[model samples]
Target: MSFSRIKRACAVALFCLTLSATQINAQQKRTKGCLTECQPRIGIVSAFGGEAEVLLAETINKQEYVINGNLYTTGILRGNHVVIVLTGISIENATMVTQLTIDHFNIHHLLLSGIAGGVNPDYKVGDVLIPRRWAQPLEVYWSANSNVPAPCGTPRDLSCLGLKLSRFTSQPNSDYQIPTPNGPVGTGLFMRDTFVRNNSNFPNGEFKFDYAADPEMYAVAQTIAPKLDRCGPKNPSLCVAVQPRIRRGGRGISGPAFLANPDYRRYVFKTIRAVSVDMETTAFAHVAYANEIPFIAFRSLSDLAGGDDFTDVSALFASGLAESNSSRVTLGFLEAWSQKYPE
Candidate 1:
């Protein structure tokens, strides 16, 4: 064969190989995006009793669960790909289980479902607050001149660390909106891993529910998000932080066996933004968002946050059950989201 003919044939082979490689790379990129932004196996982290628990039994499918030493399972509502966990109100415990559920079950899309106390007076027990905005620790300091360790463990992969730092720094306001059925919901930074009760500062020896007396959700998110986001090079972590938009009210608050305590009211309102406070949702949201997993949370109002009245305790307790009724309406929002992206 002539040299010219052989050279022409070699060029044709190289062109074909290039085209095939381009096609494969494109397909891989598409698959990764789908995996990142798809419907997640929904999980609810909540206290063991009250309207949140009752609704779980009523609406979700039943299955026994043993999560991080806790044993309880109310349901497994699939198709929507939901898994509910009753974590009993500790920030550390809730964060661990959330990570466990996400890692073991491959639940990318999560919902931190349950109720919370309301700081906003306009909200009453039965009113719901869906977070559409979010705020992370924006002013964290990394000792200015000293050699700092990687933000995550395993030392800094300068390439990845540089990318992450760039992304966070570029967005001065790292806060994002919570996706919702009606529209976008407001989101905010919640203090977590802290007690919820009245401090001695508020008008009635209670916390004003701000930075001073942080809520558990904020701490939970901080702990859970970085861990999850560090899992892989491709992980996109995002959490949907939510607070129940009313004063303290729920079955646990109202039962005949219940006793009203002023300290509980004053301290709880002083710590968290919303009035009434619950155990689970905020932590779950932090984990979800921090890991770049899409999430949403909204709870029905259960009580009025301020004022003085022990006899009025009965009214406060009764109001918590309102979550049961409102759950029916909000469940649709989650349902529609699942239909669009069945995970």
Candidate 2:
């Protein structure tokens, strides 16, 4: 073969190999984003604009990405590489975005910050709560009024044929289920226990309705509890009516509905023994538990669930300090975590 012809053939072979390799690298980047090797971020999630605004403003080296229509921004906040996701305002949105962030980025930990209703009567608005565990009270089943004979042990003394019935659909799980507080019984409403298995081959997942925040991460929050800001968002001099404080390690619950019923609020506090209740924390906690990532949350009381006396629904929004308090506590947690964990 002539030297010129051989040289031309060699160049063509090299060009094709290089192009094929480039395509493979590009596809890999698109799919996993190099899971472990990619920039590791502490995932911080908020449920709405009011909750996310301050934290998003302070994030440096900001870069934005949209996944499955959810907006996520990656940047360094409080000296930690973090990805912030605005999860709209519901359980489904929170679940989808949290998992999406885990799938697309190297998320080492997950944190949820937002304003929530004070379920614990002792707590008032502007108090930041760090729940040690979370539950989903909204995962429920509405029972039908049963005219059927009350089960074997339901008591024949209480007017046998006319007695209201309360029984578990799933015996084992129901044993641990949160009972309807001060119930009208069969008029219907039951908190059904759900199951979960992070990464198991067990045929039946474990019956679980509560997920705990990572203790190690919770400690960071506890450390900074005393240092959190208690000032107003607009005017620092104008503080909350009750001095804002941070309380760590209690329970929190999430459901689709905004908790505004005083009776139910009392029930939640009594039954789940929750300090705060909102729409996103439990969803985020559940996802983190499944992913085996460290998770924690900061929720500030906006109002007294249904105890607030307001004339207009639209006018009854949380004071700016409520969200600011939450965001500030979250930032302090992240900064403390960055030091404790060191990437």
lDDT of each: 0.41, 0.72
As a TM-score, model 2 comes out at 0.75
lDDT of 2 by residue, 161-217 (tens): 222222332332222223377743442355545556665626555556688888888
Clashes in candidate 2: how many? 0
What is candidate 1's lDDT per residue for 1-343, written digit by digit as tens?
Answer: 8999999999898999999999998886444323222333555555435645554655555666565575545344524555566555655555677766665454545555454444444554444444433222221223222233244553322233332321222232222233458964423321212122222233333211122112322222222211111111222131112222222221111111111333434432332232434445545555554445666554554444444522323333443334343454335545555455555
Pairs that collide, model 2: none
Give the Cα error of residue 80 in candidate 1, in Å. Answer: 1.4
Evaluate residue 310 in candidate 1 and report its C-alpha lDDT on the 0 to 100 scale. 29
> Candidate 2's error at 194, in angstroms?
1.2
TM-score of each: 0.45, 0.75
